[model samples]
Target: MSPLASLTTILTFISVVCAATSWTTTPFNPAAIPLAVRSPYLSAWLAQGAGNALNDVWPTFWTGAIVGWAGFINVDGESYVFLGDPDVPNASFQKAVQKSFEFTSTQSVFVLSAGPVDLTATFLSPVEPSDLANQSFPFSYLALSAASNDGQPHAVQVYTDISAEWVSGDDSLTVNWTTTVGDTITHQVQLEDQTVFGEVNDRIQQGSAFHSTLNSTGTTFQTGQDVVVRAQFIQNGVLANTQDTDFRAVSDDWPVFALAHDLGTISAASDPVIFSIGHVRDPAVEYLIANDATQNRSLFFWSQISTLDDAITTFLQDFPNALARADAFDAQVNADASQISSNYAGLVALSIRQGFGAIEITLSKDASGQFNTSDIMAFLKEISSDGNVNTVDVIFPTWPLLLYTNPAIGKYLLIPLFAYQATGQYPNAWAVHDMGASYPKALGHNDGNDEPMPLEESGNMVIMTLSHFQRTGDNSIITTYFDLLDQWTQFLITDALIPENQISTDDFAGSLANQTNLAIKGIVGIKAMAEIASIVGDTARSSNYSSISASYVPQWQQFATSSDGKHLTLSYGNDSSWGLSYNMFADVLLNTSVFPASVYDMQTAWYETVVNEFGVPLDTRHTYTKSDWQSWTAALVTSTTVRDIFINSVFKYAADEENSQPLGDWYETLNGDVEGFKARPVVGGHLALLALQAVRTQTAMPAV
Candidate 1:
């Protein structure tokens, strides 16, 4: 069924059918607690588990930067802390128990019971694809609903506060405040001489955060270096099922700039490369007038509003429907996960949420002033680790989720590479490995002393581009970039069969001469190009590439196969060692005849033997495994039993108590311990099975 129709059915019978999911076995520990994950920049999560302690550790960015802390609740003149620090206990409150922690596609609800009162704090950052106005809106809603559990009338009050540390990288920034005519308050906190996307540096950029409260008493002050905004309310003589205050937090990097005009391109010897004039926006002003509709842009994120009376009023007025949509989306995701397996339902739920949460969409205005979420003029991938578009290799794992959500987004992701190249970003024959700019900037390839992974990235780009075409059945995208694809294919034709020792995507594992697995990638890429050529009616070119790819299959099988036939060697002319020849598995996934089914069976059987307690290693070269690539290899297995063995193993790793970070992509296979690269968007790679399923069933991909 269509997602909308399925959601409608769920909403119709929700009360009767929807049962609350308890997450005690895999409790809501703070390895990942997504509170506000609207974009890469607006994302917030808890670093430490706050199960029973209301006053827990401060919430932080994926970079481990502190965003701030919020806590405290009062009932009838007695106080209780439910969010941050609870050591200074309150008289009227015993320790609150987190009864249930539930998540949807667009919302998270935490059920907490304190004394006789039951509270549901629903955190909503509506990501409804059907409503651009709500999706692009920067603000997140912290809606609190309270009721009497003991069936007695009582006066109740609650308080939540955020530190000014949220606005800028430096907590010393001066903050100014304003109170709207309505029941609202706004704080404009920012650093001095703000520059958005100026230099490509690794330090987190300083920006503005507008904190506002709706229908509640608000206060702002400086407590040491922290700027604190507190919103508290009292419902006199409260009855059961009463709604209290709602808090809104909106953040943006204003003076946003992007390359608008194409700079003329020349050669590698050309001195002093230049950039064209760009667009600069005042995010604060834009926030005030986002609803005007007269100032529309084609940018990814075009919505932001201050605590002005009209802005707060509109948000509150439209919140009911927005929230309803979020609940419906949640129900749909939950229902879908349940169908997979009760053991894996939560794992799937968290995976889907974390996958989509890593991307950031910025806004841009067009000539017509019509807000265009469709154009996605600026699709930014935040380098929570290194702040580079760090394209090709990094985006390889993320392709599965993007393909399953919208194949168009897969095309959109490639646009930046083309855009950077058009402006002479990199002077390479194949695809650019990584755009040099640090996080929040997409200027160009900026790694000063980095070596380009010609084979790794080129193979990745071609394979992903072809996968996008297969899912979308869109021939135009391939045609538009045919020249680029042809150039890369020709490069692969030359170097794929006999690769020189060079840095690959897995550079940490060091270089390898005649890398066998990488050769498979090039082979798969060539075959994909042939398929694309046929789709675009280039019969002669298709025939030429088909023969080229076909020749490599047997050559690779002969050289890469271990003498015992138990595994494939990691490199050519070496039969003792084996690694993930994951790229070759694509032939089976694409239903192509390039690689024989025996190749896949042999690799799968060998991997099962090597499986550790956590997962199969990335290769025989290292004990560390990548969750994303592991998923790709696991999807290649034909048997459901074999596939579940791998999937559940990874699921257990995700639920492990020690690996306490947001989905670490790299980890030790034996102990399920994180090695490095934490909280990355590559976690989306775990959804590769979804792409395989979509292709097999010919089902419409889910809208993320």
Candidate 2:
């Protein structure tokens, strides 16, 4: 048996039982646990490693910047820290012993022992792919429940706070905050001087951070310095319900918004205390349309709800239903993915939140300054890598998850790219690289000075467009973009067969001429255009593309295949070189038999021989590999053994103890170390296996 198989078997019998603390971590332990990741700015995580228990480490943004979120509980008048490390000087509070940690698609649950009482802290970020209102909301839920562990009743009070670090990434920035007492207690924190659409280290500098909980008899609110407020709760079990008048820099004294729930006496059952944490930014994105003008776009939730208070209250009230929906969604993903392998299921579960976290669904405003609900658009920030907006290559990798969850989301993501180019603002003959250089500002590159990935992006657009059409059966996208699509196809015909020394999607590996994988992508793209043409009743163009793609395949196989006939070359003439042909996944997904099955078999067999401890390398160039492309390549294999080899490798990397960052798509294959990227939406491609399975299970193909 393989190492992964042995590890899986060992994990079945592994459970740590001790007198002080009994621990049970199910499935596997991730490098970092996602705490409350909603949108790009609302993301938070807890790094997992030595001395990194829940109480020992602070929650961090995706960029690894500390976001002060702390939680403490008073058991029988004795304070214990359960959530974050506040590093209070000479504090008397003891740390809770974490008993278990488990994560699903939408929640990260941790059970900790605070004295004789056991606390379950659940961080839930709902993934409602079909519900635009809920999905667009930036808030995430934190539900805490306590029960007696030794059959003895104990008095408990739960305290949690959000520090001013959340308002801005820069520590020196001055922050001001307010506390409102209404149906719910809310503490709103923001920068004293807001810079709209500005970002510091990938954290928004203009948004207001709201920390709220429902107003109840036993609940009290407070806002003060982090050390002072937490020290108050540590000594006394309740806050003073006081607000600090002094507003200063985030790091000066470290201001915090706090709420405490006093459970008089806990026996067998205690009511759960729920809190909502989020960031609200008006005019979420600066979008460009066909008129060569830029307009501010508000988040889609704003159109559904008028005020921030309403959005928070509705979210807090809907916790039970939201939890149920998230549980169902998690079960469905696990059930579907386990059909292949448990490792694949774990990967799918981890990918869901990180995948959805990179996008924002926004509605454009009308002439009257009200959000136009009908004029909805979605934009994605290519996190960790240049922060490009609506990057074509980036979207290509991420579409599998969107397509699997809701096909309409895939259409929404494509609209911005299409709308920007249709205005004749882009000067390139092929597709544009991305909508903007920076996120939230999707100003089209009218100067046509965007990065040139002409062949890579053009093929990616055609393939993704056809895949979306196949799933949705909405030919309107094809009919509307036919002229541009035809133009891209023409560019493919001239440059695909002998690809110039231009970079592929793996631009980090540098440029190459006649890449075997690039050639296959272009060929499949041509075939995809044929399908698109046929859908629109353009038979002449369809036939032309079909014949061109068919003619190029034989030549591609001849030039790209190695002399040993074992694997494909990295470039056309370098027979000694080999690379992953992940582009073959499009052919499998679209069912476009452009390449023969023998090619799949050959590549599958060859991959097993070159596999490392983590997974197969991207190419002969480096030992590092992209998890997304690995999954895409895994979907191409015909054998279950080879497919599991790929799946298990990526799962091992995710569970690597040394890796403390959010799920990174690029990592070293030998030691399972992160190569460059982190918290990227491209991890959505990890669902390639399930996406292909969904495609195969369709009873009938949509008619054009």
Candidate 3:
């Protein structure tokens, strides 16, 4: 053969090997990593399943009908399933909790409960059963089955709020029921021929679908009034209800309480149920109940979970039984259906989608029995802790709107550590840009406001520094990043004094300098930076920041307040009304360490005057506003009602209510149209849920 022919044969062989290798490589395999120095492929493949499909990936379950999330693990005689935002560390922790149409997992013990009444647990899933023997379970691959609890053949029937129809593990039990929207379903699991709790004394009806019986072991009986339950784990080998393991929460809010270990004299009429939810995951946990009581018919929550934004709960709790919850379940579900029907309706019909929230990251348990990260979930390990992304700009500082209130804070919230990660120059610190593009590739700060925005960015840096310190309870970030903090503090101190030459991101209109609201920006920046000093044990620096900021607060008030003062001038001493957002950006969220609560309330009242249909305008002329900035300051109102209004306004802006498009960050209020800035990504700032959650949990909901 000629030399040319030989070369061609060699090239063809090489091509075949490459193809074969590609075909052999399974994306889900966690071990298949690139070279040591190479960047990670996608954010996550297991948690997300090649979640790098471009346009923000939606979780599998919400995508269509049956998207699976993290699988429930049957651990040492008990089973556990992560409710929302699978810790991404597990291979089974996908966006959707259900991967297969029908899920079946064979195990030993069985447990399931409804609000207060406890019963034999089995088959917790999205789809309801048509019959007791479960002719079919929704989705495929996944299953929850317990062969025999202890020695006897234990059996129980299951039902959901979706429909009264029942499915049973015991061949004889069956229920025929029907329901409509807004209706609730009551499920009972009891021993055969045993009467207990509220139900009338009846020999356990031979074919009774519901059952419950009281046993002496604290929570061994069926009862009402208790909205949550717990599991009892036997250490090593002690069996037969040794002790209560861990309890879950009906509500994952702060300061969750559980019953005492010792049972006092029990009045059969009083406390019937002993089990309680000992833990609760906040912020993210709200998604489990939403505002809907129906959706929560048989809901369960991961306990003791904290959020990046604890504010939303605090905000909502302000109106616990307020009208905010009226038709809440039905309305919300309808809204979701409307939104999905608009655009995302057909998405899952084609293929698997990711879960809700972030694609990477999961909180699971390791072999050590301690809750740790998952091996399969280690998809982005390269970029996770210490990857070489050149830079780490957290663009999606916020995430998953209603679900994730305090979301990411730019993946690495608090520190705003971008340029440091990018240039490998953690000099003073880094400039966090909401988040690094999407994830992992933190190089671009495509926020569009580059070369501009001093107040917004500067103040953010200081507060972020302080918050990070509080969270890690570590002073390293603040201590090392102090010099940079001073630079911003100094900049705010010297330059922002008059608000000249310093335009913040009150992007409703354009950028302006020395604006009245902006003065708060400077004050807050200085105060927050000083907070960093205090966190690092530098009382001197903290005092200095506080004292100086204190002096400026009233001065700014005197200077910015107008004569017939329902509102203040946007610019100091001038009638030129500009963005009122500076009120929120400065005095409210950030300067809390300095100004009195009244100041924020007053400022919020002033700020209220500027709100348009979309939100408070960036200025006097533009009918449009930036939802990012709107949510930013609007959320500072301290009043949950106001915050809810602002939050609702944001939903009004989002396609969730009607028009379905990628979250429109900028829009015109007059006609509710997308004015400009379509899918730029900085809108993640709107996710302040975690941040709000943090504030609420950390501080008392100030007496608004």
Candidate 4:
């Protein structure tokens, strides 16, 4: 071959590589993307629509606090931004290409090109629920990999930044950061002043610091108001070559009190920090390279006699296996959901992430010593402090996921509430609405009122208890709380048949007297108690409660059912008004036979007519709807066609931009806009219907 021809061929190959890697400036509009979804404190998400601007909309803690921004890609002498703002145009991007994005339960990958170099940034958190170590890890991995799409050589560099706000409760505090370089580069940042932990609402933690490290050779770590990390990608190799880095973010004194509540000042100096870290592998690396790499790349040994290093070392070694479990979980959920309907599948996928993601398993221990065993008597945080654990109403919506996914995990949620009641902290004859105490600080009922929900909460407790028993076929949990359930069920027997003005779960819509739906819940709760009684061999109580429940059904129907029989009146003695007695679906779910199957048919038909373009209104009182309840109602329809109609209506409502704010449990059905509440775990309520269907169909669900 002629020398001139060889030179031309090589140049052509390089240009093609550059063209493929060249960045395409595409519009960014994601409803929301999950990142680092380990717990309430560790959970983070990136709101879409920022469009090539990383800092445009800062990453948010599930609580809605801005954690920081961490996305940027630079190649050779040119800069093309894959994440955040691109301040400078890169020669790399002079010729544009395409960008692609992929998201899964545990990972999100973004691929962008700048000239001949292709860059892919992956955000991964190992959230296998069965693996306590991986699920409890505080760190998420941010991996950056680069390669030459074409066949020629190219140069590349990448940078990422995180703000000091991550560790600061407020900007008024002085910010200071220090840098340490060993085999890896680490940057630690914190506020100069620290405070002890206390019980408070909407409170952010203080007295904590974050340690972020870049795990790579030739890494540069810089700190200011925001810390930045840069790494060398490639020098002079085939543009087809690759380079990337492993990044870790850890907060010392996490859970600031360590769930110990020692009472001595809960400052960093006094309390032990919760230790957790994550590990990741680059796909670009071959098995030989990975196998030969240092096994203990990111372990931190702070104490002379501590085995923190070994613990982390073992975890990092087993990281890949944990990730495999996470993958299987995602696949099973995705497949199971798809069988219901496309919209149902989408809802389930998002619901699983948003609903389960909001819960934080704060601590795990048993009857043994504090650090004795790994058996997790774990407590889940409600994300919003106001809706803390065992908020019966809140748990009502969030039950399906736990019940269907892992009944054992569901038991963990209720055990704490039962323990609190057993302590006599809750001395009420009737069930309280919540375990009392705002998140992470459950001493007793903290709603600051006596029996706030009265009928509503009592009914919720009895009904969910029955549900737990049905799902697991284990009466131990029900038997353990039998007396309490009996008392609550007895309360329902008195006040529920014809409810007085009292708050229900839909308290935001205001209290209503003689609420027909609340009455239905009462009847259902009584029936549920009957089932639990039967489970525990209390045949006499079971028969008596069953008869009482049966009698109430006719009385309720006489007053609450519309004369036309098309829909139920919103309240008793108000035949002209209407609302969703979605509670009726429970009768169908429990196969209780108290309400005839024809009743479900009648309500399903009625709901179809009441549905607007967005969805069916919750009741005649307003055009607003609760998404979770809507899902339950939709799932009640026996006909697939009718069920799909309701599912699509709510799906469209959720897809609307106005309702695009992190799956609000409550929204206006008229315009598909959020009325209130977002990022709440109650979306798990949507899973109730799915769980029922799963059992009826005898379908296998993901084994937690």
Q: Is candidate 1 or candidate 3 better by lDDT?
A: 1
Candidate 3 local lDDT, 1-704, one digit each (tens):
33234334333432332131111211111100110000111111111222211112322211111111222222232333322122223222112122111111110112322122122222211111111111111111111222232333322211111101111222233223111111111122222332211111111111212211112333222111112221111111111222222222211111111111112222121221211000011111000111221111100111122321122232222222322232242233333323423111111110011111122222333455444322111111112212312121222223223122222222233332432333333222224323232233323233333334556566666655565545435565566666777767876777556766544443435666667766766677777777777767789978987888888878777777666555567777766665545345433434365665665676576654544544456566567766666666655666554554454445444422233233345677544576644323344455344345444455211111
Best by lDDT: 2
Clashes of 2: 0
What lDDT score belongs to each candidate, Candidate 1 first? 0.57, 0.87, 0.34, 0.57
Query: lDDT tens string, model 4, 83-141?
Result: 44322221222322336655555666666665767666666665555544444444665
Ranking by lDDT: 2, 1, 4, 3
| Stretches of candidate 4 exceeding 4 Å from the true structure | 1-30, 49-56, 85-98, 175-192, 196-203, 206-216, 225-319, 362-369, 372-387, 446-451, 697-704
Instruction: Measure candidate 2: CA RMSD.
Output: 3.0
TM-score, each model? 0.81, 0.96, 0.43, 0.79
**Candidate 4 TM-score over all chains jointly:** 0.79
Model 1, position 362, has a per-residue lDDT of: 48
What are the per-residue Cα lDDT tens digits for candidate 1 across 131-230?
Answer: 4444445556666655667766545555454544455554443443232324434334444455655331232344555545443322221222111122
Cα RMSDs, all models: 12.7, 3.0, 23.4, 14.0
- The stretch of ten residues in a row with the least summed lDDT in candidate 2 is 12-21
